[model samples]
Structure formats: structure tokens, C-alpha cells
Target: MGEIKYKRILLKLSGEALMGKQNFGIDGDVVKFIASEVKEAYEMGVQIGIVVGGGNIFRGVSESAKGMDRVSADYMGMLATVINSLALQNALENLGVPTRVQTAIEMRQVAEPFIRRRAIRHLEKGRVVIFGAGTGNPYFTTDTAATLRASEINADVVLKATKVDGVYDADPVKYKDAVKFDAITYLEVLNKGLKVMDSTAISMCMDNEIPIIVFDLFGKGNLKNILLGKKIGTLVEGKHD
Candidate 1:
């Protein structure tokens, strides 16, 4: 295999990825598989930072907000991310990869609070830092948090592990003939209104010139392939003026 292209990357994983085929909650088998992939990448000498979403446990914004306040619902979503982060930390550590969970909300009893310098130090020491609590703010998706952390940590690339193999012209699952692009500019993504990620996240990444590779994490060797700089996913890059 060729040498990995990037030295450090920020991996963005959705909470639903941990659910496997189950209706809800984290699935041990799936978590183990995901952990193994991370281990594989680490063995290839890639520095990894993970940001996990909380949709599996709670989606405060989408749930009935008739009585609940929007901000309160969003806070609940942030807590759900912490739950997923702890679960992932356990899984990664079991595989002998040192890991840390840093939350935006201070819950030192469970995990360390978000500290930029500390996080960078951890990454420098080759420990995977999983960021949780979604920017410690409401009305912001974990996608945005991933972009923010990726920029703060100076990651070379942002690897978004999603359900699909890559970004398509339309929903691949629903539209059988949707065309998948090998690479695209951020401007095209925004112009087309592609749902690879929320606009806020895309804009953040574009502004920072952080390349994002969107690939299917469910597929075997997908994450490892991306780390190896193999042509296995859709890459969105900054637009050239």
C-alpha cells in the first residue's frame, strides 16, 4: 500500500453509525468494527481526532417542541453526544488506542472539559481526542462542531463518515441513478444545495480551506482507504477564484 497522504485528520461520525441495524442505542459489534478501523488508520501513522453526533440518543430539534424550549432541547442533544463519546472512548481504549473525551460542557467527573491547548497536546502525543457536546451551544449541529474543531486542531483533512459512499447529485438511496462526484468544489456544493453537510459547516470548512472527504463508514476498509489517500470517496475542496 502507498503511504498515507495526510498526517493528521479529523473524523466526523454520526451517532447513528454506532447503532448498526438496531432500532436505537449503541451496538457493541458495530462499535467494535468502527474501533478496529480507527486502529487500522492509527497503525498507518495517522493522527486522528473524532467528533461524534448525538442523533441516535436524541434529536432535540426534530422531536416535538410543543412544550419544550428550543434551547433546552438542543442542550439535551449535546448531552446525548457525551453519552456517545464515552461509549466510543471505551471501544477505542479496548483496542489499545489511547483516547480522550473532551466535552464543551464541564463534566470533569465523566470527561475533561474542552481545552484547545490540551486537545492539541493530546493529539501531539498520539492520543485520539473525541470532542463531544456540540460546540456547547444550542441550534448548532455537530457538523458545525466538527468544522470548528477541525480548524482549531489544524487537521490536514476532515473525513466525514456517512451512510453513503460519497456525495451524489441527489440522494443515492432514494434516487438510484444519482451521480457521485469523485471530487467537487465547495462552491458547487453550496450552489447545488447538496446535503453532504449543513451549510454552516461547509462555509466554515471553505473559509479555512480544509478539504473534506465524504465516504461510507459502513463499507469494509472505507476509512482505512481514505486515510491511505485512495480514490474511494467524494472530496470537497475550497473553490479557486
Candidate 2:
């Protein structure tokens, strides 16, 4: 209804977010809820792209993968993202929101392989493109894949959907007196060891001059509010936001 600030956005959804109140795995209701939220933005004529993590199902860097081969564990983790992506696609499609699932790992039976031009075309055609399988390689987190895809797709900003509202001096849940910053530079986030995103992802964003907004997407209409230019999140950029 208001002016749209970010025309195209890359939403990074942690797999744990899809699990809802459960310990792991996809929760259908939560996926539908998220899909509904995304549908709001899509209806507003915003181009959407998503990069989903595999933490809920399996994290390659987690303790569960300590004894396994690092590469093998990472591949499994990538596959887990594909599962989440497919779930999201199904949810979005059920809502009558056109969507596509593209994986870095070529599993043509389930999804299309990642092709930059094709992805842009999908976005241009008013379809939400969900990118899965974390760069299709080992040793890289989905966070990095998100920034990389955002760069390739030329998204206006990277919307990082986390549990917290924004970046705080300390864990807001643990410290009642923690301070929150409305805007912060990328270097400050890395220098202070803030967990807004992984260093590789932050660095890529910094290098590419892409702004990253860390926000609590669980809040109703938070994602759409951001697109509509409401400042309700922490903006991480190369300079002042």
C-alpha cells in the first residue's frame, strides 16, 4: 500500500525457523505461515528469492557431524536444504503464489539446476525463486550462498530472518540491558564478532555493497513492512544505512 523501498529481496530462512516449536524437521503449519507472509510481499509485486538453511535437519558443522567426513556431512546438509526448499515451494504453490525451486546440486527429477539467467527470468516473470543446496559444494555455509545468489540476482537487499528482532550488544534473551543498534557497518559486525551472519557472508555483502537487514520475521508483516520502507530491523551495510 505504501512505497516499496526494496523491489527485489533475498530472504535467508534458517531451517530451524521452519521447524516451529519443535526441535527439528519442517512443520507444515509454520511453512504455511511463512508462505502466507511471503505471499503478501509477492502480491505487492515484489520479486522474492530465498536461501534456506539445513540446520534443523542437519548442520555439517554441528556436533552430530563431528565424526563424519566433512565433505560428506556438508553434502548431506545441502540435501537437507533441498528438502526445506521443496517444502517451501509446496507451501507457496498451495497458496496460489507461483514459485520455483532451483538447487545447486543437479537433481532434475526434483528441481532445476541453478542457472543465473534462468533465475533472473523467473524473478522477472513474477515468480518466487527458492535457491537450495548451498552453492552445491562443501565448506561453504548457506549464508554465503545467500549473499552469492543475491549478488548474482542483483537483489536490492538481503533480508536475514532470525529469531531476534535485531543486533544487540549481548544476547537480548540473556541480558535484559543489552543495547540494540538500528544501523551498523559490516566491519563492526565482524570486529565485534556479532552473529548477524557468518563472516564469509558478511564479507561478500560488504564487497558487493549489498545491505543486510537482520530482523525477527516472526512478527506479523515484518517482511512486508521492510519492503514498504518501515525501519524495524538492524541494517548492516558497508557504511551508514
Q: For each candidate, what is the lDDT?
A: 0.91, 0.96
Best by TM-score: 2
Candidate 2's error at 85, in angstroms? 0.3
Number of the top lDDT candidate: 2
lDDT of 2 by residue, 1-241 (tens): 8899999999999999999999989889999999999999999999999999999999999999999999999999999999999999999999999999999999999999999999999999999999999999999999999999999999999999999999998999999999999999999999999988899999999999999999997999999899999998899998883
Q: Give candidate 1 regions above 4 Å deviation.
A: 64-66, 239-241
Which residue pairs collide, candidate 1? none
- Which runs in model 2 stand beyond 4 Å of their true positions? none
After TM-score superposition, the amount by which residue 57's alpha carbon in candidate 1 deviates from its true location, in angstroms, is 0.5
